[model samples]
Target: MSSLPAPTRRSLLGGAGALGVAGALGGAVAAPAHAGPWTPARFKGAKLLAAPDRHLVGRFSYGLTPALAAQVRRRGGARRWFEWQLAPGRIPDPAVGSLRTWWSGLDRGAQELWSRQTSEIEYGWAVMEDYQRYVLLRRTRGQHQVLEVMTEFWENHLHVPVNGDAQFTHRVPYGDLVRRHALGTYEDLLRETITHPAMLVYLNQAVSTKRRPNENLARELLELHTVGRGRFTEDDVKSSARILTGWSVDLWRTWRASYQPEQHWTGPVRVMGFHDANAAADGRELTHRYLRYLARHPATAQRIARKLACKFVRDDPPQSLVDHLAGVYLAHDTAIKPVLRALVAHRAFRASAGLKVKDPGEDAVSTYRALRVAIARPPEGERGEQYAANAILWQTAALGTTPFEWPRADGQPVDSASWSSPSRMIASFELHYTMSGGWWPTAGTGYRRPGQWLPRRRIRFDVLVDHLCQQLLGRRSTATLLKACSEAVGVGRREVITREHDLVRWSMPRLLTTLLDSPYHLRK
Candidate 1:
């Protein structure tokens, strides 16, 4: 990517403000009237996805597709479809299964991964970049959309960025650990992730010992991961750090992780209400007990529930909803599935259509899905656009940040305002237009022809716009969308469109970009 001139606020606002995106995108898109999951859009004269179905699929999955919508309907509405998705083992995800073969470095062990960098065979950052591409590909093509969605949520919650020094060696394995327990109990997930070599090394726990207990991981485990801020004192942080001393990795050499009894700090420890004797050097059992206690703590439950609600329902979720989810979390012993069930059943979640803004990664992946872009395996060792996987990472970087690249341990912000800036919106607009026109990333990519967008040989422009609205937004065209499309393609609403018409020949991307730039696609 080349450097461009700095974006002025006036130009960005002018470019997107005309369509009411600058303000409307910061909140929910104007929602349609409330309808049952199986209700038809009688007013629009099209069998569009009911409001409930749209809200559920949009919130849980990357983006809605005609195929996905059909699957939701086939499973007897979104509620039933969600129930089936809870057990991902029954779902066959062949597309994402093959992606690992494309990026074999993802399967590399810690020792070899580090050795490759030491010997200049590959750079750590390059390997991490491959991991980013792998995740983006999964989000774009994976059939187990719910699993992918939760995997991202949990990964961000217990974040270990891929660019950490020697910890990058274990980053891939850390991600695998999170996915395995994505829908499992938080007690198990928190215990396992906090002990993983990636987390230890990233937060300096790998070097922590009885003589010197590193407080980085311990502080984050308390502040960001568990009870959150203002819940614990500095002395509690010290005790937490001492309790976490035994888990270590042979960093920068063999890169193997083990629980060394000699490295464990021995003393009394207390965090909040939980207390431990810490009499033995083998502190593994004590660590487990402590983590389980924290996972079941009221503050921790409230924090986890609020984060889930913020990510799935809305940024500032209602206190009542938060309290309800926390109760569910405790009632199920920290199991995530039951809590997710309660969340989707909540009225606020059902009514929160288009309330959340898509971050850069979500924006890119959803656009790829919306455009129905097909990706092929690239030739081995290819570079740039010659490799679709690599190109996709660059595409995300162009939008803003790549996946898991947040520098802080708290992970990326989950609020809509963080991702709703004019500059980000402008970048998204450019990406939509670029992908729509198939102007870049030509290799190993199959872009739909302009004619394929037309359902029939001849159709009125207004009807064509409605068809596109159905395809892109999963709803019928609105008066606002129709007017935008007309102005975008320089055609009257009632004008007849054909394959040879200028609108279809060279200007179709403009119309698609307009829809993509709309809040209907930008949010949720």
Candidate 2:
């Protein structure tokens, strides 16, 4: 195997410190302070705090949904609701037949047969559409919120470029790797990802040989996957790459053991301060030992804890809480369920408010979930198929979070600063308006009847506002918003009213546009 260049202190510092002032600020703010243990009495019957509610919904659920908000109120508070979400298997599965059918319809073999040649780009787009559809169904279906959230988290953690040739064909395996193991043991998930064909191709490990080792996969395996920054050296990365030599894809070929002894690195390698001392050891054994070491490292525990806390608790989670979760992770040998349990039970998790920003995926899925929109079945004709594809692709693009197509391996940032860009904000407003208006393109087979498309009777302004507030905002609208909506609906001409039969048809789009673009929506 090729030897690694020794890590320089300067290079380490440059890479580690690139996190900049934001990292320092996050670290400082995340320090624990002396707060008495939480007492339920303090929060009982208190006015619902907007900030905490927003954070709670953003993290535990898809985003804030009016039905979820009301359910929280009925159940007493966020703590109980969070506890339920952490143990997602306890909830029954909602009907997801439509979602499953949508996925099944995208089989590459069928598509290739029809198109006469396989376009990797087209296949990637189809898989991404299925992913978006599934996410939307998960939110709206209501029973699998926790599973969906965990799936998203794990997918980001083990990110593979979707555009690669092998990854394009094996997208199903990549997705299945995440979904099946999302809530299982963290170690298992990490190990599975290491040999997965998608990852091998995406990180250029497929061609990593003893003579000319590629360090891309090794670098990310530590920097992004296990220890994150400062915990491993460049020398360690190089050594790790050497140890991982001989791992290659069985693309389009039957999966026999792909490890070629002749191709393997039978040379000494040092990694993370330990030498593989047995230079001529079996390749499989060497790979297993290396992965086990990474999975069990203290740095791995810390990194995983911080990420979980950030996703479920706050933007900058309390160090004490993270430490506690890390301890749990270690004690359980990186079992995900126990760590999740500890996170849900922590006091900091319940108290932090307005700390997370809804990624576009979260925002779009949560809205559909709140509205109880079912994934529509494909119609009988070519027009129907085109419409279904177009609608899903357009919505995904509009939200700026088309699945499997993130610009970076880090996945889309979950901070408001990234998502609230001017163009993004405009897109959010437009999507909300379109959804609220029930304005599906009429040139398709999935078209709704007039009654389904828009309500027949005139909806009272006050009642309409209340329903929307309860459904979309999860709280009653402010008096100013209510007054404006009432004025807008009351002044429209009969011709206009007839043209837009539903109150939602006429007013909801404008109202939702305002709400989604509001500072309140941006905060959590």
Candidate 3:
């Protein structure tokens, strides 16, 4: 990869501001007073629970489909369902055939070359496209909810940029790396990323040579990846960077090239109080041993635990929960599955109602899933190619999570501050309205049609509203929302009334957007 401009603190902060969306009407709406913490009771044996409506199920599941939600409900609720997702291998791959084909086409060498060519922005677009397609397919065809959610979790955990000119290609390889080891040990995931072309480029590790060591990757490796701020010092970062030097990628070449001993400075380096030499005289075995040592460090365990807790449990999870998870990570050798399992089983995860804010990607995937939008590859001709291109590009852009295109090295933030800006809010509203209105020309056939498609069927405005309420709010709407939607429906003309299609098409998305902008939507 060629040398790139260094990303500054100001640039990163500015990027966050640019992604923020604005406030919405009724944004002050709070969760139901008696809703209580998220628990099995929230989804217990209730007569009203009808095969997990795609809209409602999409909130918790990756994509919503009646079949997928049914599976989750049958498995006994969201807690158990989440457990299955954390165990990546256990989640059945409904679309593995195409994915396998995609992977097989690349050898190690070609894979590296591809990673080097795709810009970060394009990479973001691709990842977002894949994510959207994955949700659409599962909701419309395959009905694999657990798989989708797990894929999402793993992707965010190991996020890489896909927007730079030469960064997009790295998205697939980086994503592949994450999926491959998502259920495996965190140590393994860490080691794989150390050499992964995507991470190297995104974090500037590729430029971290002996003569002028760059601390960009090293700082993030500690702050974001392993031990967060306050856990390590600037000196520690410098030393760590030294240890990571001589590791670079060959953009023009196919597979990842080996560590160049000639490029390495065989000198002493200290990381976290541990001193070691990078000299070949000490042998590659010793250097590798040190890498493994860092992987298993107690601080790494703590950092990983905190991140998981923030993701699955709550934004500010209890200290006790963090301690317990850290212990589990260390005991299990940083096994991701066990930590996730413990989280699902713990009271923290089950009881933390409305604690998390949905990132843009999650919101889009969940919405499409709930609607049961079917996304399929085009047929094996020119038309098929066009369909594929359109599907990949439009959905990603609409959802705001195009692959490999994260604007900064830290990746997209999961909190409310970054996602809830005025502009983003407007974008969300427009996207939701357009999707609900069935405005996208390319989204064919999936839109629900009454009478002709299914006799005795009529699209009921109330039913649609009710369903969307459950999906977006995990409960029915308040009197305020219900009244607003009813008034909106009443204003439509007779032609729209007889079909109830236009009303639903217009109101559903509006209602969803309004709800998403609500304070309740910002919570878990």
Candidate 4:
């Protein structure tokens, strides 16, 4: 079958940039001087998003949903809300509780998961696809948004893609492990992630033996996971490889993971300041010590601080904020929560609101959240359309990135420009329009009806526009937005809109699309 036609590059750019609206919206749009008393009196003090709250919620969560915005207010403010989110265990998460049961493949043991693929009962790619859907649903609906955001961050940082041929069976388990340590200390997280079977197999450490130690895992441990580059030498890498020789998995067979002491290379090893004597056949203790040293290294602290700042603060984070966070990381013994608290409390993070562009996964999930789309569980067999849990995975892929499917070990890029390309923006525009219209993935999902958007039976078009802006974008409406919305529906700003109006009957999608297509919705 022929595919849907894509927009021409010129048309896409023109569609967004032609309206001095999005370009002007990209910068702060001064709230309409005379537009006021718009919010319903009941929700004014409770749900109104102040500038600071919007920035905090937008920066941390996938996107600010109405429920989340209210929660931030009920909990006091952004700082208090963030503090509440820090301890994820205290947060009740019923959304993903049954995900493993829905996608039964996720609960299978490594042996069974591997056997199913080898016996052709199920494809490895299909199993991984379920994992992606599971993640998308969780991001869209989970109450513990901070945990989800940080899990994605560390999963990318110490990535073992579900597509890895040797690591597919262990991939889901690796993701679970990452989530467990996502809010914990970096030392514990690094140790657990590096020693996991998925990491070993993905980096070729499963095959590394006393006779021939592979340097792939070791080099990446320094360059990507821990100290980053320039702090360690070739000799450090070789020694690091030798130190991590015993952790192995039964590859291409049972998929069982075990520590084989005999396969370990026995020799004195030194990497940076970490040193161990050549004595024991079991090097697990030595490996743990080395990873702890690396995790606590000043360079590792700097690298982790800068990466966190860049992802949450801005594309190019300030050095002062990075330095402050690095000090917090060390002072707290690499605890993640303290570093996060320090980062958010810093002036740089507060000032960097609405500056970072959402990556593909963020964009898709946030759109779902903003639209208040309800995704139902898929049936036991095939999934698509009504099976929105599965269909949403492809939605993200069409946006140009699929979760954990980043080809290289470096994982997906987090910077703004990486996702700000014309093609990506056009793809996002198509997604906004399609979802706004409730066109695809119709089954097992519920899009808010046009009539439900009415605050009351009769309201002014501009007031309604302001309500959408506040509800969806976490801010009040700007004059440009009012004009765009009016133009989008071919109505006057002062015109009264009712359920019987044409704008509510058939042109609602166009109006919603105008807001979703704005830079206010695109940038966090």
CA lDDT of each prediction against the hidden true structure: 0.85, 0.60, 0.54, 0.83
Cα lDDT of model 3 by residue, 408-518, tens digit: 666665554455555555565555555554556353335443222212234334444444555545555454444334443342111222244544434344444444444
Tell me the deviation in Å of residue 516 in model 2: 4.3
Once fitted onto the true fold, the runs of candidate 3 whose alpha carbons sit more than 4 angstroms away are 1-60, 63-65, 86-91, 99-151, 167-170, 207-214, 253-256, 277-284, 379-401, 441-445, 450-481, 491-524
Question: Which candidate number has the best lDDT?
Answer: 1
Answer with 2 or 4, whichever has the higher TM-score. 4
| Model 1 per-residue lDDT at 344 | 97
* TM-score order of candidates, top first: 1, 4, 2, 3
Q: Please give, for residues 1-524, the per-residue lDDT of candidate 2 as tens digits.
A: 11324323222221112222232112222222232221001101223436555556557666666556666777567767666666666766656544566555344542342242253334455554555655555555655566777887888778875544445555555776787788888888898888776787778787788888899898999898898888888889888888888887654443222665566777678877567764664587788778888887889999899988877676777899989999999999888888987886788976755455566776666555544444555554455555533465567567676655675666655444566455665565566556555564334323223234223254434444544554455555444334334333432211222335554444445544444433334334
List clashing residue pairs in candidate 4: 386-443
Error of 3 at 444 (Å): 5.1
Candidate 2 has which clashing residue pairs, if any? 140-369
lDDT of 1 by residue, 1-524 (tens): 11324324322322234357654467655533443321222124346679888989998999998888888988899999999999999999888878888876888889998889999998889889989988999999998899999999999999999877788999998998999999899999999999999999999999999999999999999999999999999999999999999899998789999999999999899988989889998999999999999999999999999999999988889999999999999999999999999999999998787789999999999999999999988666755436566788888888778899999999988878788877788888889888889987888899999999988898878788888888887877666666556656667766788999987888888888888888888888
Instruction: Report residue 25 deviation for candidate 1 (angstroms).
Output: 1.7
Runs in model 4 deviating more than 4 A are: 1-46, 383-386
Q: After superposition, how far is residue 114 of candidate 1 from its true place, in Å?
A: 0.9
In candidate 4 the C-alpha lDDT for residue 444 amounts to 88
TM-score of each: 0.94, 0.76, 0.74, 0.93
